[model samples]
Target: MNPERTSAGPILITGASGQLGAALVKGAQAAGLAHRAVQRPAFDFDNPASIAQICAETSPSLIINAAAWTAVDAAETNQDAAWRANRDGPATLAAYAAEQHIPLIHISTDYVFDGSKGAPYIESDQVAPLGVYGASKEAGERAVLSTGAASMVLRTAWVFSAGRANFARTMIEAGRKRPELRVVADQRGTPTAAPDLAAAILRIVALIQRTGWQPHYGGIFHATNQGATTWHGFATEIFAQAARHGETAPTIVPITTQDWPTPVRRPADSRLDGQKLAAVFGITLPDWRDATRRVIADMLTQPASAP
Candidate 1:
């Protein structure tokens, strides 16, 4: 396919079915940026030829890669599957973007850190991945960066969105089924809204275009809400908001990560410092609580059944 012929137009987004991808589609249209959202049964990350073909065919001036293997604990046993999507998939797209000389916007995760440190992780912080999913994500981060293409690697944590199944959705469902829910209280991070994150990506892209990438806004940035809260706190908020939405709220029982043991070792603190994002963008993200409330409101009021 002649890619150069089509490179003169709108942005192209991958993982359209995912929450973040859906948000980007809406955000791009709302922001008045010409764009396309590609997802399965049309776009499949497991197939490299498909990825290459679409990249060349679409020839998007900007490519936002939101596709990823997000099953954290499942990665412990499904390592290859995770890397195929998380590492090789990104590597393929980044290589194409580099060759085409177009900017690639990549989504990353906060699990790259081991979480032993009791402070928020900065863009420059050392990474010590504690699990298979984390390792795969770290590798994918390097893969995209190594391409030397203009790219933005955004690492966010505790994402909950209205369009997809997430912590908030799970809590709301369990709250309806069970009398009480036990959530981990030790782990902490900003409960990023997928739509908010989508907005951040677009803003970065706009900034890159306006600023001419001089500041190399191409590297890693921690984009999330302004504050940190534990899983227990997050669940409590979800339940409370559900009640406010005229729905039944479940009692949330707080528990440590050990008490709610899982196959993977979760970071005690998934907090990502947004200082650089704020400084560079000259803006501060709203608190997670506010974002969460918006998401809950959107979910409860939507016509679709709540997950």
Candidate 2:
């Protein structure tokens, strides 16, 4: 593999408006790294010209692709849009990065696995996505890897943050109106804070730039806050954390996946094992509960209508 030529140009970050993307931009600035954040209209995945245009304009030395069509339920009826955004758009970015001879770090999801392993999934675990959303993301992973570019596909699970629509924000908003909340206890995965994930990504990038790309740096790796919990457990922690911020705690009812039905079937246990990331790059995210508290604090500090 050819080592990417380091340049003084800005690091290009896509999906700058989303939770993770926004956090990535913040992390980059705090690290004093020059970067350019791009989102829809100007950097749309559906519009191939927009993708090419941004690449030419920025002439980025490195690229972080955080853009995705993350509407899981909506993707059921909107397969075409999901594929275009999650699969096609990332493919375009991967190809561009390959041509430019730059390393690309693409954020992915644990949903790429079917969650039937009854144990934490490693990077090489078999993938059997149950919905179009996961399938598209899995396809995107393949696309990025197929480009033969120096790329890192980092898969995280149950992402949440202070910005945008996320589980923490949803639960907090619901607690304000509802007396009790029913969360699925059957499904299990790690609750990844966007800021924590963003920090990890930036660290990985810095390591690559510092030592140049190594053979082990390319390919898939699991990244999320340490530990795992069911959705019900996650909700309980959210309410608990919100209580510390003077918010009222709601009655959290633990229910099975069968209790609530959606168009898509999420994995029953999609917890990702993050050993490879730590072993390869000496990077590990903060504890899941600590990360959860940080995000809950951020949410409580925000205006009521922030989400």
Candidate 3:
């Protein structure tokens, strides 16, 4: 490891197989940073022993946690699994980081906010999650902070990438099969591109290693693409971009949240304010539309059964 790098040991990135996790691994390699990307069985969130085993094996200088129980609807029925992945798992990782005096970068979600505020939420906004998934993630945030380790919690929304089964790919596949699709228009938030987020995270990591951990670095911050849009709006754009890539476009109908019933309640408007990220780290993701277009373009180049 380079002495000028953040840690003398390699950076350990959890959730190495997920969308964002894969992106981070790519970004780290592109930046020529030494990193160890580990996922389940070896670093399974449900198995706390896996967490300790991996940390001990790597002896990482820094850790970036991208692991979580991300199935929103399933979380309602599988609360125990959700808690294990989103809350207890992260709590275990944070505790271990604290014990080793390693700085941690943990990923969070915008669902922590109830969305009743009717405005973009900031770092200090009151969090009132409506379902098990959101509540569990919020609990993990609190757990990480309570450990008093040098940590940064990034809360993002609507993440997608060409590498995983995400919204953009789902819409594309659905459009290819159906002539029309109904999407929720009442729920609104920024659509973040996984690669863009991964890039921003790596930049932060380099800054921390170069400058050392600063007093202002250990806190929560909103990190997403530049703007917000409803699920309907996002789907429409996805099909529009898909059309430009020679894929068939579907008729997307806007529907209210009530039109689509699910096991858990989602926030109507969970747009997060990302100004703090720009102010503190001088980092901001690309505009949502641009990021969406890039992801769609990348997806179009892949085979139909890429995921």
Best by lDDT: 2
TM-score of each model, paired residue for residue: 0.95, 0.97, 0.97
Residues 1-307, model 2: lDDT tens digits: 5558656589999999999999999999999999999999888988999999999999999999999999999999999999999999999999988897899999899999898999999999899999999999999999999998889999999999987899988998898999999999999999999999999999988987888778789999999999999999999999888889888888999998889999999999999999999999899999999999999988878787543
Q: What is the C-alpha lDDT of each candidate?
A: 0.85, 0.92, 0.91
Worst 10 residues of 1 by lDDT: 1-10
TM-score of 3: 0.97
CA shift at 186, candidate 2, in angstroms?
Answer: 0.8
Residue runs of model 3 more than 4 Å from their true location after superposition? 1-5, 304-307
**Which structure is stronger by lDDT: 1 or 2?**
2
lDDT of 3 by residue, 1-307 (tens): 2222355889999999999999999999999999999998788987788888999999898999999999999998999999999989888988988887888899999999889999899999999999999999999999998997778899999999987899988898888889999999999999999999999999999998888888788899999999899999999888888878788788898999999998888899999999999999999899999999999989997786443
In TM-score terms, which candidate is top? 2
Q: Model 2: clashing residue pairs?
A: none
Tens-digit per-residue lDDT, 185-270, candidate 1? 88988899998889888887787555455434668989888898999999988888888888787777888888987888988897
